[model samples]
Target: MDSKIVQVALNGLENILRLGEQESKQNGMGINPYCALIEEAYGLDKIEFLQSHENQEIYQKAFDLIEHYFGVEDDDPSVVPQVDENQQQFVFQQQEAPMEGFQL
Candidate 1:
């Protein structure tokens, strides 16, 4: 219901997909099966497939696995970085111009 909850769920899903990609690579597979499934659904504009009732069950199970394996918590406040006002402000300086006739 809450956006934060959705974000956490999405993060969990991403973690599962990342692991799938790594496993696929280790097995000499060209494409990750998990990512391929998402791509196929996305081609039909079916992004909601992840949120569908059936998939939600799978996602919840995968999320639980991710939490158990990675020690990730959806409600961990320390997960978010706290930036102070000074840290939020960044200043960039321009580099000096290169020589006009320089050749590579």
Candidate 2:
């Protein structure tokens, strides 16, 4: 609804992407499928630890960071974060779904 809110959402995605894969290795939280936890992780902001090392190519740690520290699990719905309406606008070329009876 606001720029700060939107920015926080975007930043949260990055933080989850950076942490969830790692958190799963420990705690044995059993890979939550509805990953609203990623958003929960954002509120915690522990992802700040990752900001300095983001450019490195070794993503395993980054993934582990996500999986473990940020409470991400492979089966978690958050693992496949949804593209919000604003994000969908930028990610795909839009063509409306065809109606069943209105074939072109």
Candidate 3:
């Protein structure tokens, strides 16, 4: 696979992760930028993450972040959470018909 694309994206993601670590510096030197620059180095680790293949871990991380940001989680059939009136619109719309076979 092409590596240049991976390098560019990893650089972008690293730059994002560096937003909070700007204060910690050692004589004006820090690992944040160094770590961020690893995107250009000859290695597959960063590439694999920034550019995931079919079974990449980065995909999972991305999904997790999405779920967290959306305040949603996988609904387990074995367990159900108590839903209040306000959440009915989100989980089950009051105007929508409930499935006949759905159990409480």
Candidate 4:
């Protein structure tokens, strides 16, 4: 893909995410529909891949968009932890059968 087109796409996505975030805050909602939709559509993966583009500007814009909207930090723990909704505790270690004995 062209660098210019990629930059434009990233900018547009950033704008949409920003607006969605603002709307979510104003509505006192915990979920941002726009963000959720993007995630569901695997947009996050594409954004991450774009971060490695040859063009510095493209990569930087991708990085900035992710850092600003995703709230990811360099100091974050490496473990892929999941929350135990039932017990309200953090499960840091990976589970082979995380859903074992779990009930809706």
Q: Would you list the C-alpha lDDT of every candidate in the order shown?
A: 0.56, 0.49, 0.47, 0.85
User: In model 2, which regions exceed 4 Å deviation?
Assistant: 26-104
**Model 1 / residue 62 / CA error / Å:** 18
lDDT: the better of candidates 1 and 3: 1
C-alpha lDDT of residue 28 in model 3: 64
In candidate 1, list every pair of residues with a backbone clash: none
Quote the positional error of residue 14 for candidate 2 in Å. 3.0
Question: For this target, which candidate reaches the highest TM-score against the unseen true structure?
Answer: 4
Candidate 3 residue spans exceeding 4 A from truth: 23-104
Clashing residue pairs, backbone N/CA/C < 3 A, model 3: none
lDDT tens readout by residue for model 2, 25-90: 465864542245645656334444443443443234445445554553358553444456865643
Query: C-alpha displacement of 49 in model 1, angstroms?
Result: 13
lDDT tens per residue, model 4, 1-104: 88888888988998899899899999999567797898899998999999889999998998887887776546656665678999999888754877568689
Tens digits of per-residue lDDT for model 1 on 1-104? Answer: 55456557667667867788789779998566776565566621323433343445545654544444334336755454555577795444446997697888
Q: TM-score of every model?
A: 0.38, 0.24, 0.23, 0.67
